[model samples]
Target: MAAISEALTLSAGALEVVLAPAIGGSVGAMRWHGIDLMRRLSDDDRDAGNVLGVAMFPMVPYANRIAGNEFDFEGRRWQVLPNNPPERFNVHGSGWKQSWTVARSNAGAATLALEVTGGAEPYSYRAEQAFAVSEKGLSVTMTLTNTGPVAMPFGFGLHPWFDRDRDVTLQFSARRFHLEEPEGVSGDPITLPPELDFAKGGSLPGGWRNNDYGGWTGEAIIRYPSRGAGLRIVADPVFKHLMLYADPTKPCFCLEPQTNASGAFNRGRWNDPDEGVIVLAPGASAAGAVSFAPFALTFPAA
Candidate 1:
């Protein structure tokens, strides 16, 4: 059927992004100058329904892992079965593993939606991802609505893996960093150290880093000198955390703009203001956007 097999494409100027609503509502590909900016998704991978092969995926209802896949909220216990097996926790919520419906699509834009009813859980919600392309690059807007009868904690984020170039550099500002626990869940908050700071904009850390940066200024810069272009990433204020995952030995890196620090559902309920967690009442909704705008870079031959 068309709904199960077709991939939607959106383009503006030289920027293009593809969406596959059938599998996790992810961006299948993103390209500039016919060169991949975001990692490309292959047809084989798509047919196999592999989320890892996609350029990017949306994290919704919640983001990141929940320790032990169980947490207590408002005197009731919520348990989530591990969706990504061999993994002890419930990672990246339920949206990415479920198919989404395309609400609308055009040459330069598309909107996809996923609905989840808590049923036995406590997070009935509706999540939407809207993509728009322009000469400025790509704009992704994520929205979540609490569709259940009770209020619940929720978060929204875009998980984009960018291709790495030898000269690629990153820059962003955050007030603090959340340490990671042995299980990859957020542990405690600490001030940003110079070695981990990108305030001045620099290459990805030479070592592995998988932590959440709090108090993000909602902006980031990524440059690829070999390509003679760079991107200016801007986000809505609601996105208060910038999560960077870099492994020097890897061929890609990720800089995620999200609404709340990971594990906020359990340990951070009391730390609302600073952690950026959103507790929405029934029928209430929240939305934010992230943009990637490209600019040219020039270098003279020696």
Candidate 2:
């Protein structure tokens, strides 16, 4: 077997992106004007199993937690192990922990591939990731093809760990929200509360929040007041759910563009488009892209 190399670097104009496909296809680093836009990776991150050390990683076949670690589809039940510790349920699918092979690469673009077989995980699919950078920004396209013998549920998302600052602001459109239960499972849908609303883009709150927002308008903007820089986030319509994870005392947090709700697997509402879930027949495929563009943010004098 040909193994993945240690690292691959790509750049265009003022933007640069480093990838470590060998380490679970995670992004090792992303920068703008030599300043990191995503969290920087460390030596521990280079280890294949340390997903938290990654700047960004893909959630495939399905995204987020599945209640009780099991789901039913087409009259069959599938069980997934607890992928994360201190959490009894399986979180995010198996891809982030699996190594990916580089299919192609260049100065400003690259493509990586992972072939996941059944039995090893719930879904057997061929997943691919394409990264391209332009003066405009960095764009990533992720695709997953059902290669198993039966039909199954599918979802995808890009989990990017943005560096948090004291004066960071965020703005996005989401008509509804899925509040999580105590066990980290989504309880029910509700209107956006005052604490959860960011339609006008405000500073990240002083509390912890981990919820999935629906009815996304397909765009978001994040600005760092101190750094006087910002990033524009845009994703294809396949990604209708936006997940924002902010902790009161964390140096970094996540802004994820995902295809479905947090616990779409156990909801059994696969036919509801608003839930963002999709059913793929054998050999069928689904994909979408997420882009990040950095721009100058002019802040007035104190």
Candidate 3:
């Protein structure tokens, strides 16, 4: 494993981004005109290298949870231990907990890479995250390549935490919703209920909302009315699903863009278009980019 002792910074125009390469290739903070676009990672968390406190982090090899911490592929059974303890399942993947090396950096962009071999996990791969900032906003491109000897199922995504402003509103389109099962695992896909639907746009749910929206259109808008700004997320077509986590108890919420559905591996929906799980062969790679563009909102006189 490579070590990156300090966090890298990228700045352009009014946008500034802090990348914590050592902390799971996570973003420490992102600000546009001094207004936080996401939940800012505290200085204490940055010094301690706490990934859970990061504003955003990469999810490579896979995303979300694996039922029973095990799955079968290619006619063979593979098992993995619970990565996130007390949850009873492997949440996210090894990438978010492992250190990444700074591959390249400049004034407005930096790339961090990580290499992993099957240890307690059953997959080996190389992942890279390219972070860049511009006058508009920030962009992150994540790429994952299988380095193992056999074909295996792979997935990747980005988990970003945003401040749940009192008047925050979210908008996106999806074909259906994945029901939430016990332990927060993804259940069956069903008709998106009216309460969970955000087709036209709506505010965050007052109750718990940990579910996945399948058949995502790869675009979303998040408005922070109190801040007088909004963010637009545009992702590559490869990202077919989006996960929304809005626990009313927390001050922040998460909107994740992922290539695979939650529990896709457990369901073995390899050929299913809705699952979005990629079967990568040895030395194969999958890459995608997600861009966040921020704009100021104009309001009428009170």
Candidate 4:
């Protein structure tokens, strides 16, 4: 809950890195242009009030709703807790809202770990979160190892909010996409929904927008024309297969790269062939990495 320990101002480029060690492990805070790029979740602050990014995991599906919250996996019924209020469903991952321990810290990076045991029915996992800031950009890697004897289902993803405006363009290579019903309404996929279309590049006209897309090639590019700044997010091809876009009537938008659909654990639809069902044997481990590379486009000084 508390930032037990931290290290800062190291010779690691112009970026300012802060490491906080707590009971769970460690949480690394990276600052760029006075903007907290990642979501800061602590005992006091549980949301990304200032930052624009957060790595999501352990399992990010509607385990508490939609697909019925009951999955017949391997001949067993698993019941997950409902974490979402309005929709009354489970969204994102568990550890994200929980406090993490600060294990180690240096000027460059810090590692945070969280342990969850004996959760609703079949959702127990021990996870480690590592955040690093370098001259290139920010990198977050999470490793979840099943300590339980039984095989449990899980997934991993990241929620990073970016500045969205007329000058910002989001580009990524994908052959297909999935559009979700507004307000978590369950239904058939709307092929190439206007908001879900990013093939030829476009801009956010305005209003609230939230949906999921799949079939990505493991790369995302966000360009800021006015500031001449751009961020390239890359993920392990074997880790992420779906991308969620959410623009909630703000100057920012989220490009979430996920391992499976929001309800894949139960629905069993639209799962990435390359990345699906994260199963870990007792003492076995599954690790995935997400990286953000920032570049300042240079031109002749006016």
Candidate 5:
């Protein structure tokens, strides 16, 4: 497969951006935050392999390791291929890390597509990814269509690693929380741990975080205290859930806005039963949208 790349410029008032599209359909670079917003690979950067930003598709459970990495769907046990080597489970989705085909390109936005054939599983999916630079912020959309001959279980999300530093404040709203057990414990839902709540807005005290939350009204605010630049992430009411990860030692934190709870397919713990688990029939298609808006915060510099 040949890799294709393109560049585009979008400006809306003070929000001007230069976007680079990689053949892999990933946003290679986003200029904002007074610098390139996305992390680029460099020889001296030890964490260069990290995914700066990618459109998550088909599914978005943190991983499949919990619950034995096995789930019974339609009376058959479907085992997902483990993507996390040490943890022994599948993660994000098959296509986030997989290279995507660039279908169209221009100076303002690019379209990328990918297909996944279920080989021992019970589902197949085709996804179209589009990234556009706008004065509002960076907008990414992923649409998944099921082409297989049966109802398939699926979810979608975005994994954007934001720069983690002492001067950043991450804030979001949630009325309830779901906690993932530490290693060696069973995957079960626990009450809102005191430290994980973000409804009041505060700083994360640097540590490992692999938890999911429900009851999100589909909105969040991330502020870079030093730059006075803040970002607002909003999802349609249909995608009413979100996930937060603040690993101080990892150099970044993830505020993943998702459609359903983690491991929803296997666990059947859809936050909203009616809007949960996208079951697309053969020849059926499903779509959802999420937006990221950048804004200038008026807080005094610390």
Candidate 6:
């Protein structure tokens, strides 16, 4: 179970971040000036160590699903068991379900590390998350190193859940949208539709929306007019894909920044630049960072 007593807290100015390293390296909560920037975990969930209830979590080795729980790489076929049940496939890899050790930490920063060799997934790698909070905002740098004996395809991403305020607005730029098949599988890419295109900023849809945005600009803005504040997401170039997930029946939504597409492994687009897959040889590493900066929202002559 996840114990809040073991969680670490970091604060700077009006921002505060609580990290539950042992709880799948997830963020228990994030607040700015006492306003929840992300979905805050409840005490019951915290005590239960429920990752799904946390504010955010890390997706290592890869993100999203691996169709049929199998794939081929380097002339070798590999298979992963169904990690998330009732889904019929492996989703989000194993990082979010494993415990992480705190390599180092201080008042304003912390680094949590995990090593997986002979895990459920046919990949062996070491992952680290370095989180730092400053007066400006919070920044998380994710690093993944292949620790196996051979080359392999790898990817990493961050999954953050945000509160779905009635007046919240989102904006970002992407070249194409990966269509969604049944059971949340990612299909082929298609031109962005008028409603799905957010280059000009807009409100969340009233229905279900779970899709990946390829060729992302690596930046996004989410505004909460009710709180008079907004957050700007700046990601590194390595993260070329952005995923938006919003269910009207839920009280929260997700904006994920990842290195590869939702089903790049299954799509067989390993070397496709637009798919954002990284073929890393043994001992090679890939790293990137994402920053969240909050700013005051300005209304016109309100």
**Which lDDT tens digits does candidate 2 get at residues 60-138?**
8788999988888778888898888888998889888788998888789889999999884678999999999999999
Cα miss at 142, model 1 (Å)? 1.1
Candidate 3's TM-score: 0.97
What's the TM-score of every candidate structure? 0.95, 0.96, 0.97, 0.78, 0.82, 0.97
Per-residue lDDT of 56-75 in model 4, one digit per residue for the tens? Answer: 23233211123454567677
Query: Which candidate has the highest TM-score of all?
Result: 3
lDDT of each: 0.85, 0.87, 0.91, 0.57, 0.60, 0.91
Q: Clashing pairs in model 5?
A: 8-107
Q: Per-residue alpha-carbon lDDT of model 5 for 103-218, expressed as tens digits?
A: 76565566677777878544578887676666677677778788787776677766555677678887787655666665422244556666777877888666666767767778
Per-residue lDDT, model 2, residue 10, is 89
Q: Which stretches of candidate 4 lie over 4 Å from their true place?
A: 1-11, 17-30, 33-66, 185-195, 205-207, 269-275, 299-302
Best-first order by lDDT: 3, 6, 2, 1, 5, 4
lDDT of 2 at 70: 89
For candidate 5, the 10 contiguous residues with the lowest summed lDDT are: 55-64
Model 3 misplacement above 4 A:
1-3
Model 4 earns a TM-score of: 0.78
Tens digits of lDDT, candidate 1, 19-79: 8888799999988877677778888998898997788999988888889888776778888
**Candidate 6 structure quality by residue, lDDT tens digits, 1-302:** 23424899989999999999877899989899898889998999888988899999999889999888898876788998787777898888889988898888889998888999965557899999999999999999999999998888889999999999999999999999999998898988998888789999999988899999999999999999999999999999999999999999999999999999998998777889988989889999999999999888888995
Clashing pairs in 6: 2-49
Q: Cα deviation in Å at residue 105, candidate 5?
A: 1.9
